[model samples]
Every structure is written in C-alpha cells, then in structure tokens.
Target chain A: MGEENVMSDDILVIAEHDGSNVVDVTFEMLSAARELAKDSGGKVLAAMAGGAALAGSLGAFDRVYLIDDPAVSNYSPEAFEKAFTHVVRDVDPGLVLTSTSTMGLDLAGGLSVAWPAPLVSYVVGLGREGDDVVATSQIYGGKLLAEVVVDSPHAICALIAGSFSGQPSPEAGSPDVETVSLEGIGPSRTSALAVHEPDSGGVDITAADILVSVGRGIGSKENLEIIEELAEALGAPLAASRPVTDQGWLSKPHQVGKSGKKVKPRAYLAFGISGAPEHLEGMRDSELIIACNTDPDAPIFDVAHYGTTVDLFDLVPELTECIQA
Target chain B: MVLLKQLPDLVEELEPSPDGTDIDREFIKFILNEFDDQALEEALVTKESSGAEVIVVALDEPEVDQVLYTALAKGADRAVKLTGVPAGTWVPTHLRAAILAPFVRELAPDLVLTGVQSAEDLDGQLASLLGGYLDLPHAAVVVGLEVKDSIARVVQELGSGRSVEEQITLPAVLGIQAASQAPRYAPISKIRQAMQAGGLEELEAPAPVDSADIAIAQVRIRRLYAPEKSTHAEMLTGDPGEVATRIAEILRSKGLVKA
Candidate 1:
C-alpha cells in the first residue's frame, strides 16, 4: 500500500470532551477546520475517543471516527493517541486540528512525530495558501505574532482556545459515524485515576453580566479589597488574570484567561491587567471592555473599548463611588 | 530527571531583527525558562521524596553553563550540554528534539522531565517529540508528580482550573507546568562551589536532522514582528474622578449597571 501517497484533502478535528460532554474547543476546532476546508477543497471530519454518547455532540462534523473504547473514557494519553493515530493513518488527512489545551498538547506532538507530519502550535489563525498551510501563532505569550508557512501537504495545527466560534456549532445535522477498528490499541501505559473538578458554587464568572477583573498590577493581596469594592458596587463578579489566582489572591474560579474560564460578560472591567494574549483570549469577546493600567503600551489597550493610563489604585475607589452614586 | 533550557528572558524588550525572520538577540539578556525551572524543582522534589538521580541537560547556549552550574548547586546530580549547535542561535524544536533523542536514548532514563513549554515553543513539543523518538509515554501540563516503584502518579491541569490524575509507567516524558513548591535558590556561595568543581559534562552532539527530513516542514517562522495595534482605544483623560465618572457613564450606557 502506498501509505505515504495516501494524503487527502480532508481536515480531521480531534474532538475533546470532559467525561460526558464535548468541550467548547471541539466546536471551535470544527469551526476553524470548516474555514480551512473551503480553501483546500476538503471534508471536515472529526474523531472522538470517548463514549459513543459524546458523538451526539459532534453533529456538525460530516463523518466522525469514533474510538468508543473504555480506555479512552477518560483522558488516557496513550490510548487516545493510538486511536487518533489510527484515524489519521486511515484517513490520511491533509490537516489535523487539535485545541492547544491540556489534552491537545498531550496528543498533538506525539501524533506529529508518529505521523511524521509538520506540527504547528499556538495557532491563532490558519488558512490555505495554494498548497501551503499558513498559520498565525501567538509567540512570547502574545507579544509577537509569527507567520509560519508549512510547505508540506500534511500538517498538524494546535489551535489556541478561543481562536474561533467556540460553542453552538452552526451545523446540527446527524453525521455518519464509523467505528474505527482498535485492533492493536491494547492497555495504555498511562492510567487515568481521577479528575478533581474545580470547586463549584464560586462566583460563576462565565455567567456574570459584568466582570470586574484585576491582574498583576494589583500588587498585593491586600490591594484586592479595593477592586472587591468596585465589583460589589457594580453587582458584578470579581475576576482576575492568572497571576492573581497563581498568587492565591483569588480562588481559581475567579480567574479568567486561557488556562482559566472564557468569559463574555456584558461588560469587562480590567484593572491592572496588562492583557497578556492568554488573558485577552478569555475576555476579548466581551460586549464592552474598559481597561486601566499604568503602562500606555500594555496590550490590554489594544482590545479595550475604552482605556486609561490612570493607576488602578487611584481609579478603583473613585469608580466604585461613582457607580454607587 | 529534567532538562533545563536557557533562552532570551521575556522581561527584556523583544524586537524583530532587520530581516524580520527572528528576534534580535544581540542586546537581549538570557535566563532559564521559567517552566524549566519548575521542572528542575519538581525533579529536586522527586529526589528528596523518593530518592532519584536528577540529571539536568540542555543544548549548549550562552549562559547555559552558568544555568547548569546553578542547578548543580541547588541539587541536581549531574549536568550535561550537547555541543555543536551555533551558540545562542534559535534551534528549531524538531531539530532540537532530533538532536537530543540520540543522547536521551543513551541515558535509558526511567523518567524525563521538562517544563511543559518554553516561551519560544508554546506547543510543548519537546517532551512529546522526545517521547516519539524514544517511543515512551508522555504527559503535559503536569502540576504534581509522585513516583513509586516504576509508576508515576501525576496530576495534570486541564485548563479552567480542572485537573486529572494519571499513573504513567516509568521510562516516560513529563512536561511540568509548575512545581509543588517554588524553585529553590542556589545561594551564590553554593553556586561558586559547584563552579569550582567544574562538573558540566560535554557530550558529542549528533549531526542536525537531514534537511530532507525537515522538508516535512517543521514550521519555519517566515517572519516575526511586533503585533500592530489595529484599534486604538479611546483613552480617557483628566483626574481619577473624571476617569471613574466616564467609566460609570459607559457602564450605564451599556446597560451593565442598574439605573
């Protein structure tokens, strides 16, 4: 069999889920893949490695390669890799899309080396330029953008979370499902023991209409009280960038960023946050954004509808009073 | 137990070179990648808890020798540098992985650890690529790791603050996201002691991967540039009170606050 020459104009979306439900990034990958498909004249295929029930969530995909193996019920890296690789080899897709998240990173690189395909990660934008795959990746935590043109026909792209329309995939028609034969995928060397879910009943920032967020510029845990008052006055949830959560100034639930929750509140008030690309990826889609930081060049300004150079310390209490008044 | 890499520190201002293909490194200072530092700490923690040899390896780079020496002072058992690449030049991750594979195969290590990612390679490719080259199981964004009797129990972060725990067989690669504790410091005095001993080992570097092998296109950065600001924000001015008043007005106009 001429396996090496079997590459086709099909982009495979590796769908990820949390135990039972398919995560939003799966749809995002499908969305991005659909865009790529139009240019490459390819079919948007999907592969899921969990319970068959999860396949119901992948209706947007035309064909789903389901590896409904119990070993992949959770996120067992080896089993998932083996099953996904089977699809990649079987389909010989021109492109393979995976989210640049925990599960995606675990599989994408291994898949790349095993398949011998060119790999691109941190992908924010992807398009086909004739035979080449052009990817815009956020490097240096979003400080600079790199235009990587992969000359090869087969490429693996790990799209960063929030790179496209996340949930509510446009197409909802039932797709043809093919059960890939997992003949050789034996027990994996990696065993999934447990998943400690994030604490619930915390201020659900994702559901907040208005979000008052803070970041490293808040300086200390004590300074958080000032922002806390602003959030309370506006009756909005208090959110923070990763550093605030990392420093234990706020619990994990209050954090908003790539590694944190993706929030689209009606209003996003960012104070002291310099707007690392990670943080922006989470809150940039807010209906309205207002940012305040001491630095004029902070990337937060690039996305904010309204911005200021006023120190957060000098601005928050006054803002709180004005809101209350 | 871990690989430590030193690269241009992000704290320094990054400017694209005149050619626009890469960042200008001539004026930038270098520091150990933060994630790699965490990996080193995790290894040192593993060493203290279960008793394991921690060997820190890196490709030769400027100030990398000092970075390794500092690791030795902190607690690593040995330091290694693969020689032959141009000093401080940006090495493609594919080539870097390929170059390290031959040597990593030599070690026949039970466990290989590295930071989940460096700023330069956010894809977290090194661990997985090495796993592919060496044919070992791998995990990424691992926040906690505990090894006992050929089994490595790890807690991997899955964004949105959720995490899953897994038990990986030994002879595996792990991309550490953070350490259970902050990386320990190697007081300058101890660092001097490590340097006096001159323990950094130099291994024969393998020839770079064939250009033909790289034809699979290992992602050449065709260009790098500062992100152009597309939409400048309407910058509010005047006193803090004035700015706050404006913010309040906008919030109300957006129907974000109760009238």
Candidate 2:
C-alpha cells in the first residue's frame, strides 16, 4: 500500500528559504508547479521549510507545510531530507519539483535516495509528451538538447534558473497554510561551523549588475590592479575566466564559466580573456559584451558586441586613467 | 578508493572531421584530466592518513590502463578496468548507475572519491548521482578532506566564495574538484612495480540498469568554430598624460567611469 501510494489533486513544489527569509527561486518553482498543475487538473502546494518567521513571509500555497525549527536554518541533507520525506509522505503529490540551485541539487539527490524515484535535473523546457511530462535538457555542453520523459507515477524534476518563463503571482494569491513539524530528527552529523562570507565586495561577480572580467593575458598579478581600478571607476564587480582563477590572481568566487557561476550580468567587459567555449556558456546572456584581448585570434571576440585587441598591460592603465579623467 | 576515467588521446572538445564521422587528430591529445588527477591524489592522501587500502578504477580503451598504473604508482593499492565502457559513452547520471553502483556494492569501500567533473563529460552531476545510488552522504566540489575517528570531514566548494563543511559517515562518496589538491607524480620505483603487476584487472562490462529507457535520441552539432579574434584596439596615440586622458574618456564613454 505504501509503495503504491498516489495522489491526484496536488503538485508539490519545495520552498527555498534564505535562513529566516525566502529566496526568489521558491517563487520560480511555484510558477513551474502551477503550470504542471494546470494540465493535470490539480492545485499547487508550496512546502515552506526553515526556522521561525521563515514561512510567514512566503505568501500563500494550497497547503503550506511548515517546519519551523532552528536546526532547519542551515542546510543538512540528512535532516532536511528526513523532514522533506515526511512532508512528501503527507502531501502525496503526483509530481514534485524544485529549483536547480545548489540547495536544490542536494535536496533532489537526497530525495531520490529516500524515494528511489528517477529525477531529471537542469531541465530547460517542460511540455506534455502524450500522457507524460516531457522536459528538454541541455546535454553535451549545450551542443545538443534532449527531450526526456520519466514514465513513472511519481516524477521529480529540477527546474533550471533563468531557463523557464515564470508565471506572474496569482491575483488572489492566498491558500490555506498548515504547519507540519517533525519530531526527533536531531543532532545533524555536520554543523555549519560558520558561514565565512568572501570579501568580493559582497556582490558576486557572476551575479553582479556589471562585470569587468580579466584573462590570463593580463601578464601579471600587479596588472590586475589596473583592472580593479577600472572596475572601481565603472562601479562594476570583477570576474575572471578559469586561467585567472587557476593562477590564484583572483579568488574562485569571481570565476565565471561552466565550472563556475552562470552569470547574467547587465554588462560584461572582457579584458584579455580568450573566450573558451566553456567560459561563454556561463555569461553569454549578458546585455552588452565588450572584449579586450591582445591576440586578434582570441575567441572572446566572437560573441562580443564590441571588441578591442590590445595588450592588457598597456591598455589597462590607460583605460583606468581615462575613466578617472 | 574508487576508479576515475582517462581516455587516452581525448581532448576537452573533440574536433569533428569534415565528414563528421571521426574526430580530428590535431585537437585530440591525452592526459589524466587535471580534475581526475586531483581526485586520485585525494584518495591517495586519504589512504595514507587512514591506512586503508586504495584502489583505482578506470573505464576506457585498453591504452588508458596506463593511467591506472600511474594511479597505482602514485599510491593506489590496486586498479580495475570495466573494459568496453566506451569513452564519451556516459552521462553523469548513467555513468554512476553503470560503473559506480556495482563497484560500490562489490568493493564496499569505506569511502569513494572521484573528480567533481571530468574534462570531457563536464556534467557536474556525477558525484551526487553516485552518492545517491550508494544511499550514502555525499559532498561535492570538495576542496578539503580529513579523516578523524572514522568520520570524514569535507569542505565543499559552493561557488561565490562560500564553502560548507560536512562530516560524513564512513562509506560516503566525495567528488574532488581540480582545485581541491595538487596531483602527485608517480615515483619511478612504484611505477616499476605497478607496471610489473600490470595494474590492470579486466572486468566484465556493467549491464545497463535501463536497457532502453530515455536513450540519447540524437547528437547534432550545428556549428563548431574556434572563437573569433578581436581587432578593435583603442589606440591612444599621445604622451602619457594625453593617453591617460584619452583612455579615461574612452572608459567614460564605455560607462566604466562613474560620475
């Protein structure tokens, strides 16, 4: 009976909270849930998780299952999965979805372990394929897109951020909120000893409004000072390709690429970076792309709207002085 | 101890020939991926610190056995090859279910370590899937690992300069990032022994868990071109002061200058 457990009325979406607050992705996932529920003729449920005051601000859901414990603030897969499993058991949704953030990946992976269900992650598009839900996934470094379906009763999928079009908030936007508490899932094996925030001006370059990206051709670490001066002059954050981060001239947080952050900066200024395909996938969505590299053969010029070929050592100081002037 | 894959003469991005049937030779070359080597180094260090025997596993063409031997020479106690596991014939999800699931069940190692993502695959999803199948705790982008009292302390790299420390129980899986550790060179003596031992345990291919579910529908490469070059160099022809002022004006026009 437990194995064949099924639900027909609701599609559940997990709520992502930022400590005591809610994150934007939670609403994004809800938007996705509402879409799926529309076709399935079901309602959407948002499961709010975290410490006190967390669920209060998260607005409405079909049934807001709240787990307000101090221990739920920091993410622990073991405890969160246990709490989430309990909620999933109670809600019994036909489909479950979460945003494909780092937390989403962890949650979905652990949930797959607990539920033993197939999970489709980083889904780019979702549509109906016959009776099943088909999702498009970018495979082989975005070179190929695959449309896949999990022909199972219970399906778990992770929605890629910035890939899906979100529905506007409901005009009425109020649903019954229920608080569900899990007892005795305690003593998390790991503890968040501390959250050490990096000193990258608080705004991550990958998530910055404006990004000034440097490359290996900057020649030396000292030359980075000129880039920094330009960044300061423009009020832009700094990012780098793998080479700059690998060289230890810039911290890893400022690194943007397939291995790094998927940034969508309003303006991306490339300084001396030879565009690696791996690097372009992460930041091609920038509103404006201006590249500066000495080698005319540098790849960064391909996708750049405006391009400049000049030695960074000579160009940086001049650019900084001009910005100051 | 766990196995990592190295496809001899494989490039990060294979250059397709004009016919699109075979890869171009010029763009293809081989090395133990910088990330996979980092994983191997972590497994070696964990063995040294805990005195647990370490083994290396690689699924590739026969030639890649040398990389496995290189792993042993760098201190892996043994190696296994799930032969016929074609290079590039893997997605992160399927690879874990195929290679790692049975391997984990059979070896039952206290821990399994792998590169966070392979240079060729670059899925960034393998570690979590392997950990999922093992039903074990997993930490990825792990830059640090230490063993004390049979518990593994791992520092996971969460981009944007944040790291989360997780203490996993024994028999957990960890995916090592390239930045996690420096790859160690194989000693000549160990290399000699490993070569003599052959460092290759040819094993039967893993049967697919789903023989025909969700197959790779097709692989289409619309375009493959090297990145184009930049030709617009804003040359400021003047004295240092004049050049600086012109550069400042350019920066201002580019909106790099504020106020």
Each candidate's fnat, in order?
A: 0.76, 0.20
Please estimate how well model 2 matches the true structure, expressed as its whole-model Cα lDDT. 0.64
**Candidate 1 interface RMSD, angstroms, 1 decimal:** 3.0
Which of the CAPRI classes, incorrect, acceptable, medium or high, describes model 2? acceptable
Error of 2 at A300 (Å): 6.7
Best by DockQ: 1
lDDT of each: 0.83, 0.64
> RMSD of each candidate?
3.4, 6.6
| lDDT (tens digit, per residue) of candidate 1 on B113-224 | 9988876773336887778777799998888899998999999988877888999989899998878876778899999999999999998787654532553344677888
Per-residue lDDT of candidate 2, residues A1-325 (tens digit): 2434343547788887545346556777777677767766787787766745655554545667887766566666556766786788777776787755555656665665556455666566665544466666543333334455555556677776656555435464455678777776655555544544445555567556778898777866777888898898878888898767755687777888755677887678888787765577678778777777766545566677666665666666776666655
lDDT of 1 by residue, A127-147 (tens): 876667889888876678889
TM-score of each: 0.89, 0.73
